[model samples]
Target: MVKKGRPDKRSKTRSQAAGGGGGALPSGELIGPFDRTLLYLAVFLTGAAIMMIEVLGTRILGPFYGVGLFVWSSLISVTLIALALGYYLGGIAADRAKRFQLSHGIALAALATALIPVFKTPVLLQTNALGVRAGAFTSALLLFSVPLTLLAMVGPRVIKLCTSRLESVGRSAGSVYAFSTVGSVLGTLVLGFFLLPMMGTRTILYGVSVGLLVLAAVLALYERARRNTLGLLVLPFVSLAIAGLLFFLGGDRLPSTPGFTTVYEAQSIYGRVRVVDESERQIRWLLSDSSTIGAIDLRTGEPEFPYLYILEALPRFHPRGRSALLIGLGAGQLPKLLGRYGIETDSIEIDPEVARAAKDYFGFNHPGRLILGDARYEVRRLRKKYDFIIHDCFSRGVVPAHLLSVEMLQDLRSLLNDGGILALNFYGYAEGPQALPAAAVAKTIEAVFPFHRVFVSSLQTELTDHVFFASTEPVEFKADKVDIAPSPLGKLMLDNLFRYEHKISSDQGFVITDDFNPLDSMQVRKAEIYRHQVLSDISADLLAR
Candidate 1:
């Protein structure tokens, strides 16, 4: 029987632990109220770190695997799976005798996160070599699964530590989740709005690592002081030192093939921006998300991309243009031509850095208004109608779905004067299974404008740039005069342009509307085909050396 005055050993220990207010934990060492507060703070940060990493992981994976629908779906799935596994395992671990030791897991997570930048390039390269869907899945699984799991474990463990009795369990879990969710919201806002746009990926990753390690240090110091065990406090410092070593040893290298020199690179809000100089060809390439935007001949300062030259036939179709609007600015090649012809040109470029890179490196000082923002919104706000409008916008060969919808086509048509011309540069095959994208685009355009014509840059090429021309009145091609005194190469390009032009049937496919647009889904197979071709080309280039 138990006595009222003196209890048994288990009962006495329980009383000492529960009634030991602001003293040692049940594990036989001190972790006071202050320490508990710090632990909660650690929980808050852990939540934030997980979300920040999830958001940034897409940017990290985009250069190689693309930010396509499949790739994004894989990333989101991987993150959710990791978090679920963490929750289950953390709950089991929390039931153990030792209970949750905040510093131990957090310190390890800090080190793991720091190592991401170190292994990221090689890991992604290896996975992306596997091809599109598999590569996107494997890359997300390999790079993020481990760190996200460990980071997620902190939440359940924090809930376990903060609660002392069955009565307080509800309150404890609720408070921890509330704090964590709020932290996640703040982290998303801060990272998306401020950090990502201004910072490099490696810089952001390392910063997060340092932040986690510092929090671990605080917990380590408090644990050591309370337990009077100084030996274990060195763990946080060691993790930090190792992180520093990884960063110094393995810095982010530019994603490029051999013989290509990286002239300029940056992490922009939209995607990765890279300017690569092809030494052999004496040309420079503007790459966004690892796809060539436009290339310029370094010697002549002329656009070297065949597609842009095909578009040079724009003014010939509609000669009444004293004013023109260009929807996309890639190295400002088209607008420069328009400006040179003394047409009051207004160009729209979404990315500010792309425009800046154009001016600084590509010599794109076209005499026109360079309006900065999304073309969809900017077009709606325009007060004046244009005689010529060029739609050459593409993100890695996929036109943004919003811009291609029937409503958008109608809106663009409304912005044009009577007999005005609209020229669009689209990349896809004009026949076979790959013809669907071009066919859909044609159908949508034909619905808006009564007269339209499609011209393929090359009939022999499987995937070539198809320039679509539409006019209020019937459109006809009239070659620039012989006495115009244009460059010999420019004259050759214009002469050959008519030869490469081909017709596309508008009755072949359904129209793309805003509500039922499936362009991204339709382009998946084409994207995969392109992805494989790129890998094959890279391999061939490497083998030829």
Candidate 2:
């Protein structure tokens, strides 16, 4: 029944049973133990690269689009769809070919990865101009779909090559998938904890490219006798071309601030941190995740943010505060101000890099004020009491949902002294659909504190910083009786006092509780509007110049 000059099935069985011996091919090519080893490595690296790409995709898109739920959802959906399609196509190709070669797929994926850095800036800016939802979807598609699909194909093709008989198919598929999953887990941990922090995104991408090319070179050497010499010789030049392309096209270009230059920039697990100095105005800005966290005017050592002036009104309500607690150490300006008033201030900041940037760039080196960790957990763990507590934690354009819940307010109340004042800085529109977020926050605070007052940072501004002053004792904003100060900063604070308004109850609207809070959902429309406005502002500024 056997054909003439064809290797017998027994030779295939013997090689597989030997667990790494010479495997006879039914078609033609010989596969030794080392070749089999390369096959497994190919599958593992492919799996690892897929997850690494997905996680890094967030960091890549976060600055322009934001790392919100929308971007994440889009990344996941696109990856899944691409992988599914790749699996089907891989199976068809494996069936039609005389032999399954995984090296080609790996090489293609490597080339694609190398090309990502070159395409990132142009592709992201073009897609983002289309708006967040469409932009996030299209960007993910353009950037990751092709590479991930090619990587996905490696799995099935590897399985096909490794299997000698129909009965061993189950073992072959399971072994390949198991290695791939393990590699994915390792990639997530190592890259997130070690590589991402240690290297730039582009540098890490280049490392991945180099690793793949090395694997491809080794595979090509294994099959060199097959006369694939020309392709092998051209690979290095192609890689050089990709690297050269990235260098020329990957540079960031934005509207120049007339007298400002970047002082520092770093990427951390939390996000991107940048410190930029405006020399003409003598102001330095601390930006996290592409949003301004705080700005300081160097000429005057006082905070430039108008909402901070709410601190000036604190003593009028609760005069004898000896200690204070500040949440969200944004450039440490508030805490520094509190220290000047002789109030011992303790500040909690979630990101240590943010704290570091504040201390290094903003001169937030006050002794005994910085506590690095989550505000909610740290606040709950604190056994000490404070006369004044300020809640100022924010991410991008919204307050962290966990910090704005009713239970969080109740916990803050426990941390306050008998007559302590709690000041909260929130941003939202006054009367439009954007007002809903602030209104919901006010309602949640009201649910916990019976006495609270709302003050808009600017009387003429609609969607801006709104500070809430809440206390157990009766609070007052006696803007008329107070002797208005002479300094420019003092005058601004005094003028802001006139905009004080009573809190609006959210009895008819949604209240944010720990159990049922959709803060991101509530801010979706506003965020979209805000994103467009921000992009327009930058574009207009660039065009004007």
Candidate 3:
């Protein structure tokens, strides 16, 4: 029988364990309040760092592989695999070891994260030869797998450390994961909204590595203080030194090009925007990721891309057009060109960085309104109508399929005047599996506008940029009627526009709608080919910048 004021032996043991007193487990020890707080903080920081690294993966791999479906797929798949393996291995280690230190996993993770910016160039260069799909996956795995895996282990070990009683195991695990998930949410928001735009990829990566190392050091100091051992505390300091050494050694300077100089470079939510100037050739290029979105002759200050010439000529079909709407303002060339014809142009640009680069470097000085937002949403908000609407948003070898759906075309059509012409620029092959996206675009455009004409930028039938002009009435390009006094190259392009005309059959592709748009999947081959061509033309070191 138990005394009225005293508890039984078993009940006393259970109470002590639940209360985190001595004899909580076989180790006969438990973390104090301060130590437990540090552990939870570590878990939260690791969670945030994991998400940050994952988001940065796209920006890191985008230069070589492009930000397409394959890159996203590879990144997501690799992250899941790393997390799974980490969870399994961490659970096994937690169950086997009598005592586990969270600092060990964190320190290793910090080192791994630090290695990314250091080894990214070599890893991407080697994997780039594997082609887009395999290269993106392999690059992501080689660079991010270890760090993500190590960071993932923090959750299990933290749950183990926080759970002092079997009865509290479920609650402890829930609490640990909840903190991690909240950290992830905050990390994603901060990275997308602020860090990527302000710091760029390499800087953000270095910061994340240092932050994780600091967390590890704090945990190490706490653990060492509790155990009365000073040796393990040196590990975090040593790791930090190595990380700092690597960061300084692995600088983020752009590699030198033989004849070109980098005039400007920045990171946007869309991708990396760079301006490269070739003095000898008198040409400057505006690049988004690996693809050259716009180019201008430094000597003449006129657009050099053949597609832009075709776009400029197509607007002449609607002779009475006094106002124009330009979507995807690359270097603001189209708007500037339209302004030359006394046409007031309103440009819708998605990335403010691109707009700034265009004005500062490319000498874009259009006196019209520059609306900065997604074309799909911004088009719906516009109350005014336009005589011509131009769509040229292709960049980084991937099309924004959402913007090309039948629904989006209808919106553009709604904004057009009766004789208004809608010109779209697309990049793909003319006749092959890669041609499906272009064919789908043509069909979707035709579904909205009855008459249209397609023109290719290059004479070759291979992968190239194609311009489609659609209107309610017959589309006509009277080159003889318009006398804009184009350059020799532009004149040549204008003269041969009909020679480059292509008519894609409806059967080749179905109408792409918002509910069922397969344009991304269909353009995979084309994107790979286009990216490869761009990569071949430019040095890998230049793109790595």
Query: Using TM-score as the measure, which candidate wins?
Result: 3
* Candidate 1 error regions (>4 Å): 1-24, 27-36, 97-100, 248-257, 480-489, 533-545
Clashing pairs in 2: none
Each candidate structure's count of clashing pairs = 1, 0, 0
Local accuracy of candidate 2 as per-residue lDDT tens digits, 1-545 = 78999988987666553332121133433456775687888778878888888888877776667678778899999899989988987776665643334455667777888787677767876776577888888988998898899889877767766765556779989998999898899888888999887766666777777677677666656545444445543554465466547645655443355565667777787766767676767877776654568888878767777777766666556657768888998888876666655677889999777888998888887755678888889988999999999988875454588898888999999999988889998877767666878888888877878788888766675667778888887776544443434246755676557656535556534668889998888777666765665454333222111
lDDT of each: 0.76, 0.73, 0.83
lDDT of 1 by residue, 364-424 (tens): 8766689999999998988889888889887544468889888988888998998898888
Residue 80 lDDT in candidate 2: 97
**Best-performing candidate as measured by lDDT:** 3
Q: List the residue pairs that clash in candidate 3.
A: none
Name the better of 1 and 3 by lDDT: 3
Error of 2 at 136 (Å): 2.4
TM-score per candidate: 0.90, 0.85, 0.92
Tens digits of per-residue lDDT, candidate 3, 265-372, equal 888998888888876778888888877888898888888878888877755687778888889989888877677667898899998889999999988887878999
Model 1 CA lDDT for position 416: 93
lDDT minimum window of 10 residues, candidate 3: 19-28
